[model samples]
Target: MTHFGSNTLHVSLVALPDAVISTLAGILDVMNGAALMGLGDAKAQPPFQIDIVGERAGPLPLASGVPIEVQKSIDDIESTDIVIVPSVLLASGGWQKGRYPRLVAWLQRMHARGAMLCSACSGVFLLAETGIFDGKDATVHFGYADAFTTLYPSVTVHPERVLVISGLREELVCSGASTTWHDMVLYLTARHAGATTAQAVARMFALQWHQDGLAPYIVFEGKSDHGDGEVLSAQQWLAQHFSVAKPVEEMIKRSKLAERTFKRRFTAATGIAPLEYTQRLRIEDAKRRLERTDASIDEISWRVGYEDPAFFRRLFKRTTGMAPGAYRKRFCIPEFARS
Candidate 1:
């Protein structure tokens, strides 16, 4: 394993064929900036020695079809303080095991030798493939929660959390969603270098840390592909009639199954109960209206089938972790506001 001095941290970034180029570049730029900023202080040495390593040493094509020249192969690196795997473009089958056997082995070796493993968005799948995240809480893009859990039943998947620190020693860290490298890098910088240096780097890049996790942006569409024909029919009906008040009884009737069986099948297929599914649909609609319209919150609430405005407000906050007004202020279009 490579050894680090107290003054400098070595970071190895894994570049996969379908990796997001911007996230890779942004991480490098931020680490380089942190190193340079630390150099500005006479008392402190540079903070990071960053390298872009891949499974093979060559020009790798990114998701955007741009080619990035990797500095070295994963086999070339003996050890690093950290390994960052940026988001990958998931295949239709999702993350299949043994896809990158050598790379997975290298990651396992690095972690066994005490490297901190970090991933953003779908890159978490790569880490999960190494079996490092089993029996630990990890976060991924909210949209992938069901797929991820279904794939790795042992790992505790927290789709709504912005970041999660796993491992008994907290060596594995994960960030949620695309573009969450902003938080991952900042948090890493703070942990390895210092919070002060992290702040400077954040200011230098005009980066805004998402303190609210992934709840605010989640669009809660239920998963409907689980092959339960009766449950699928219920899902279809709910999609067309989600705005109706207390649609569960009708949903059960439509499914043509006993109440207990319908509830079980629905939750098994969708990973959520019927009532929560309806609430998610309503909240999703309310979020869109908040972003696109100037209607009062009460108006939007009633339009989405909430009879009691106060109850709607509470449910909105419970679902989204943001007040309706705050959500609008953050996401509202100026043209819509004016109109």
Candidate 2:
């Protein structure tokens, strides 16, 4: 949390196999750009010294198969003010145990030396494996939430959050999704360079803060791979008839099990209760309508099975972190925004 006064901040971005190429390049550019701002001369010493560090000191291929020359190796960097882990390409089976033991050990050592650790998107998988995030609140791209939770049950995963800060000194920072690196960079700038410089960088890069979190972008496809045939049938039925009156009751009846058994199985398979699943279905439908049409909130709510628009508004906001009108304003077509 030290500001850039006279000492130049050393920021290191970890370059590992499957690390995002653009993210490494982007962070290097932004941090260096922030350092050079208001220096009055091109040759002035920048406030930040940015380096791309890898396991080895050489060209490394990223997830996109593009090669970036590493400026330093992890062995060369004894310590740094900040260490950023960019999103990696998660395999179909998700984070593998002991796949990157060297990198995990390096992260643990750096954090022990008081280097702030930050990650974006699936990069949190690496940090979680470092064991620093065990008892802290963290977040990742919503699509990876279930897998991340399953892998690290000790960590508190807030899938709806856009940014999460936890650690003894609030140095363990994480951002949701890939593009959210913009938010993370700006936050880091503010933390180390002050708000004025952070704003300058924002204006320079046209970076906007994502204050509304990740709920609006989350597609609620309930867990359908849990292998409960009866629950799967009920899920399919509800998908087509989620807007029906008393849909949960109808689903329970169609499930052929006793109501208690049906509810238990549904929750077991989907990780959500039947009523909550129904609500998610309705909210997702309402979100689609809000984005694609100029329909009034009341009309959309009624179409999505809510009898009262007021109640629907509350539910929509609760589920997505934005009011229906606000969601529409943020995501609707350009013409709709202008109108």
Candidate 3:
């Protein structure tokens, strides 16, 4: 339990000249929803509010052609309850020109004054650039692990994770990718809004998968009988090429079993039928791309070998409880929004 008497949580988004504001804005929307509902606490005061800050104050464009207006500045850094930096990718590949040096200095200044700062995805670069996380446990996008490790050898990097929460003395650093941005902010939401309100927000957003206790990835531990070398080989091979166009009858022959026996054994071995397992693989594959790339729904459907966009949408919705667009929005904000 935390003391909330006269205490406020201030969220500051570290903005660059070309940063995607909506990407961060969407997260604040989720946080706002939680806060407005009495912020999950009868004793706690209403949330202080979220403000976007950078060198200047005005509208900022997203890659999606959407220009989001800003209402604050890095000068607001000193009074922030908790500051957040969105993962800002840079062309220079380091925190110099094309980066916010003044904001970097501000982070260092605020940390020294005991203010908490958090980062999302590439935003870790901003904090790392300040050298505040040296010798501390921090995380960034998995794809940038090499560059991050090489660039900041003084820090302990947590790769292979979408989110990382670091609490050190007076500072708490929370960060991850956009998908994980939901998780980090929601965790804060739960603290301010209470568990019930946080759950409500998660349900409304169709983000049950972002639950605090859930693992980022599922690990299959099939029974030994199912993993009987040959069966596992068959499963892996089937995963490699079990397309919708691939005939199940041909695969039955390949498995050396009658169709009925094949179905039963497949279910027995994997807790799902062979065809069902193929769908799982395809869905997982689709999900990964949805998280990593900025492809349109129709394009993603084709890439995953689905011929009908409508059917693809249905399957994706059935599995994820959200549409492809929302899924992508949850991970990487689209290019048009980056404008």
> Which candidate should be chosen as best, given TM-score against the real structure?
2
Poorest 10 consecutive residues by lDDT, candidate 3: 212-221
Clashing pairs in 2: none
What TM-score fits each model? 0.89, 0.92, 0.57
lDDT of 3 by residue, 193-308 (tens): 56766677787777653432212233223334556554576676766675546635656777787778877777787777666666666767787788777677788788776889
TM-score of 2: 0.92
CA lDDT of every candidate:
0.86, 0.86, 0.67
**RMSD of each candidate?**
3.7, 2.9, 12.0
Model 1 lowest lDDT segment of ten: 1-10
Q: What is the lDDT of candidate 2?
A: 0.86
> Is candidate 1 or 3 superior in lDDT?
1
Please tell me which model should have the higher TM-score, number 1 or number 3: 1
Please list all clashing residue pairs in model 1, or write none if there are none: none
What is the Cα-based lDDT of residue 176 in candidate 2?
89
Clashes of each: 0, 0, 21
lDDT of 2 by residue, 251-288 (tens): 98787789998888889889999999999999999999
